[model samples]
Target: MSDSPLFQPFDHPKLKTRNRIVMAPMTRKFSPGGVPGANVADYYRRRGEGGVGLILSEGVGIRRNGSRPDKAVPNFFGDDALAGWQAVVDAVKPTGACFAPQFWHVGARPDDTTRNLPDAPIDSPSGMPWPGKTVAEPMTEAAIADTIAAYAEAAANAKALGCNAVEIHGAHGYLIDQFLWDATNQRDDGWNGPTLKERARFAAEVVKAMRAATGPDFAILMRISQDKSPDGSIRLANTPAELEQLVTTLADAGVDMLHCSGARFSRREFEGSDLSFAGWVKKLSGLATIAVGTVGLDVPAKSKLFDSFGPGELDEVERRLDAGEFDLVAVGRALLADPDWANKVRDGRIDELIGFDAKYMTKLH
Candidate 1:
């Protein structure tokens, strides 16, 4: 392996990744009937066998009616789903890469109303995707309690099925993110008070519950992003101080690490501060966090601005990693394009690494 910090081993109480490179969770609707089968297992096994350090599975729905909006997206709970995931764990374990499933719920998504649960009511913190628009009634206390329990139970199942870690999908305008964003969560209750800490309470409760359900060895990761999808205007915290408060509350509640997401990983998170989102998180929480955006690539994933079909490079990523800007690096489309990304880099075969291509994304590589 090259003498880069990104190639070093990671040994923590909660996880022991083979290296500091992580495969970010990217959704693939390959599973049918919400069940991931042999193909899914083989898909992940290929990545593990290809030399990824850790593999974070795509957003998997819990055992709730509204958990998954797409029938093709995998579920984390239920007999068939768990069986499929257990097989996946078995398949990937031999490659020495740890795996985690990201729990997800698309609360109040206007488009997903009829996808997973046609008749089941759509519910969010304030019954809207944003302010001044009502998608459904505000979630009842019982509904909120059930959602939290579902998350905890899912974590327990993941632990039992030999998953090395678990991630709560509290990002990208999903259910948990709905609770974090002020525009979506306008509740006056404990879940939504006037401050960022208050807004984090519900998500904290879910993490605390997951912590109680799983052992210390079971690494728990929480993914949070300032901007939601499409809209891009939503932000959980406006300033560094606000971000500190928000992440601290969740960390204190029991999150082992944070997966900070942005369009550009190393870009400045705020004015007059050069710290990236993950940098601020690592500094504020004193916990390991994943820095994700674009690595080894010039354009963001799913971007329409494909002028030259970028042959992405990694000099900037290596510089930031060597500088200790973030604890770990999460590569998304780059890894998807070339499964042996980490291996090639470790072997000093930089020329072998490929760039972002739309064709590679056609399948869930």
Candidate 2:
């Protein structure tokens, strides 16, 4: 176990962890009325006690009318919701795990008409959730400014709650991704442009605002993906040079780390290179990167979104981590199925690791 880099400690100027295992943020919609209860706090506490080095809370909505599709998704603003999150932090910190709340906004993604804010105006860059699909009016500059401010406010709240860091959900075809993708952002304004770098203005500004709110010591992480929602083959940057430009823009704007999401962590990101998405991002941005996707599953996440899969060997992941391909490894479904995943791996209890079942998603366990 000592030879495996997965158990090694990770140290950075703004972030440090006992091990390299991170609990990837997965939406569990358990918080009622946008406020997490004691159950939510206990759920996170178990992960910390189970030995996860870092735990990123589920996607908590920012202070915007249509920031989330469902009221049960939890919120990062409001006194009641912030108080609920304070309890969560209090519970997890005692177990020796660093915590961060993933601030999110769904953007042009369709809402749950029956249970969500059906009448609220959904915010999008150009009102298109996907290419050639317009559902509403483009986001006005004023609305955009307000959204950015809301993100900054959330970051300040997280810091005040004693969180180690804050993550901005910029991946998975959410509001921020909508602006980054040219197909969804067709506005004839400063926010939209032909080049990917130009399209990154909105994300850059968000990072910059959050940086000012949290000060220099607090770490700010942004999640990015080549695959956008409703389309898995989407590539924000076709080549490494293009990816460098986009990431460097965010790095310049004050992103302390990058969480690169992929369907399979082992898959090569581009031709002629074995480096994965997280590897390339770390190399380009010169910032810590978290590699996530199917860390313990035999099948890719896209292939088994709602089905159970057998356990996968982590020799490759250990090799990559030992090689410094990425700084951290995030496990989602596996951690959901077994909170003590990190401990089991550390103890060389490979056979004891549980396989992920879809049923685990329905409850806090």
Candidate 3:
């Protein structure tokens, strides 16, 4: 127990940490045409220069047209995308920070209006994600195989482009999250079934494919959460026991580090337990963990994106970090509001911390 969250180091054999703070993967939506450019490079470089130990690139689509909308988030597929990501990597490397990109697929969450292209197909675990609306049908066996291959290809490309690692976006009600959630996943095929292990089958296969592609040294991180974004649906092993099982299975499947996401960092995942969701998963899986939420801000980071406000408290975070419940901490909106946030906190200039506003989220270079 260090008695402070602001400054602490996490030492895990798989995850090399320069400091205790991880620049959480916050979607900047700045990439133009799914390609990261100089502006995106500068954005990340600034953060790294300011002392962000590890930088998780925004949710990069595994394939073109796989995202929720025509946003600026970069794509990992294609030669152009690879070159663009290389630029980002080149920019961040000078700061001597570890970097990884979050590989993602939006699944049924994409709207026809948001996709920009009307013909882009949105796939799901089942033909229907919710009632009365059909975006696209469930993935056929061929489609599933193609997706797995795409992940492997993208991972290889990432390694080629000099990315230190890759994170499979297995959370937040995205493609993988859709399959993990029982409500969205109602298929009876080999990929989907009632058993938890079966639900984890697809993700496991993708991980294995990526592992073979990236080799042994490059780290592979996994991001998971109990709640999904957009509607904030509870999914992916909601209970603590089930969460333990889920994390254990993923760890066994080859995740080097587990980034447990949540809306609030301090709250315990299970009732009657002092351990938070990250705490529980770290304890259960015995892996390096990064805890992320509304840390050190006046408002909950995503309130405007949805429709709500979240409680604010830094003392609670400090208390938890002192207890050694989690290895690393992720700052989303706080870092977005101020790129030098980590430096400020470390210099004991907490009074200079800025609150994030919704206006900043839409601005992309």
Candidate maximizing TM-score: 2
lDDT of 1 by residue, 17-129 (tens): 88888898988889998899898898889889878899999899987777877889999888998999999999999999999998998888867545587888775898887
Clashes of 3: 0
Where model 2 places Cα greater than 4 Å from the true spot, the runs are 111-115, 298-311
Candidate lDDT values, in order: 0.84, 0.90, 0.77
Q: Tens digit of lDDT per residue, candidate 3, span 263-337? A: 778767787887888899889998877788887676655546544546556677776767778778888877877
Which is the winner by lDDT between candidate 1 and candidate 2? 2
Name the weakest run of 10 consecutive residues (lDDT summed) in model 3. Answer: 1-10
Select the stronger candidate by lDDT from 2 and 3. Answer: 2
TM-score of 2: 0.96
Sort by TM-score, best first: what order? Answer: 2, 1, 3
- Supply candidate 1's per-residue lDDT for 279: 89
Model 3 spans > 4 angstroms off: 1-6, 233-235, 299-303, 306-312
Decide which is better by lDDT, 1 or 3. 1
Q: In candidate 1, which residue ranges exceed 4 Å CA deviation?
A: 112-114, 298-313
Native-to-model Cα distance after best TM-score fit, residue 145 in candidate 2, in Å: 0.6
Query: Against the true structure, what is every candidate's RMSD?
Result: 2.1, 1.8, 2.4
Query: In terms of TM-score, how similar is model 3 to the real structure?
Result: 0.92
Residue 24 accuracy (lDDT) in model 1: 88
Give the C-alpha lDDT of model 1. 0.84
In the predicted model 1, the residue pairs found to clash are none
